[model samples]
Target: MKVIIVGYGRMGKEVEAICAQRKHTIVAKVDPVCGDAPALTKELADQADVAIEFALPESAYDNVKLYTELDLPAVCGTTGWYDRVDEFRNLVTQSSIGYLYGSNFSIGAHLFFKLVARAAQLINPFPEYDIMGFEAHHNRKKDSPSGTALSIANIILENVERKKTILTDKCDHSINESELHFASLRGGHIPGIHKVIIDSEADTIEVSHSARNRGGLALGAVLASEWLKDKKGFFNIDDFISERLKYTQMI
Candidate 1:
């Protein structure tokens, strides 16, 4: 498969390495740097089977929009610009192109989402348990309370009825019972870390996922690109995981 990498930063470089290791051809590398292919164009889009984007938040929407407009399938790993997701979905549907986006592309992190949901459901009836979330990432990470942290919070809120709201800021006073407090810390070059803590007077339970490196994320993006090549319309990691499980059942 011919792949076009839409960002040439850290994530994009990792994706390029993995794609090459997996024997996929890289048709182009687009970045904000001048002279890096000048600009993404229709002719370039036609040369690739799919495009994988890990660009900046400010440019992610434009990159995906260009891909869909060119009738190219796209797998986006960029976060922080999801406010326009509805608009992107509408465009994908109208253009009849495939699109998949995820907050965190690590397959393990995706599974962790389900684990957190189940944990929330199991503890739903136990008023003794109070839940809180904490996330830490590299200092350079643009978004605080990272997208993955928000995803985890949303899943917890869905299964745990008690948590009606998410608070991402530090609280000097007591937090409301209906609120789930999320603390975000940024420090040295850590890849990412997320934890959900459920506590009571007796004991405390914690569920967490720590990234060792960017390889998991990069590999997942490549896998998503492969799954999206011949498909159309809007989709997400859940759709990809469901299809994989179905195929596994057949085997």
Candidate 2:
């Protein structure tokens, strides 16, 4: 695969290493700083089959937009810009380019999401079980709760009958029964750690996932880029997971 790497930061560096190991060529890199390719010219993009975007939340929109405008397939790992996903969805609809995104691309994290989802469904029948969770990341991380944490929270909210909303901030007073309190901790050199706690008067159940490093995410991005090279549509990681499951079942 010929690739264009957007954002040459820590994650981008890892992506570069993974691409080389996977034998994928990087055609261009686009970043305000650290970008060697200088600009994402149509000529540069033309040489690449897909672009892997790992930019900051603030600039992610434009980075992905450039790919769509140039008819380049994109696999995005950036978060905090999903509020404007509808805009890009429309762009992808008008074009033949493929776009896939995920909050955390680690396969373990994807499995963790499923475990938490199933646990929520099982506990939904018993009113005694109450769900709450927290996520911790490196101090340099900008997003507080983390997009992965929010994704996990949404799974709980969807499967559990009682969890109607998520509270990502502090609650000085008593918490509401309908609210699921998901806290965030930022410190140390932690890559990522997410935990979902199901508690009751009798006992407690915990489901969690800890990312050892950024390598898993980088590898997943490259793998998704490979899978997305010929596909056309706006998709999320779940679609990737679903396809993998289908193939597994077939073989």
Structural similarity to truth (TM-score) of each candidate: 0.89, 0.89
lDDT of 1: 0.88
Candidate 2 lDDT, tens digit per residue, 152-238? 999999999898999999988799989999999999999999999999999999998999999999988888888887999999887
Instruction: Return the clash pairs for model 1, or none.
Output: none
169, model 1: CA deviation in Å?
1.7
lDDT of 2: 0.88
- Measure candidate 1: CA RMSD: 2.5
| CA lDDT of each prediction against the hidden true structure | 0.88, 0.88
Local error of candidate 1 at residue 164 (angstroms): 2.1
Q: Which tens-of-lDDT digit does each residue in 1-251 have in candidate 1?
A: 99989888889999999999999999989776832675789989999999888888998778777886798899999887878888888888888789999877898898788789889999999999999999999989888878889889999999998889999999878999999999999989999999999999999999999999999999999999999988988999888976886888821
Off by over 4 Å in 1: 32-36, 246-251
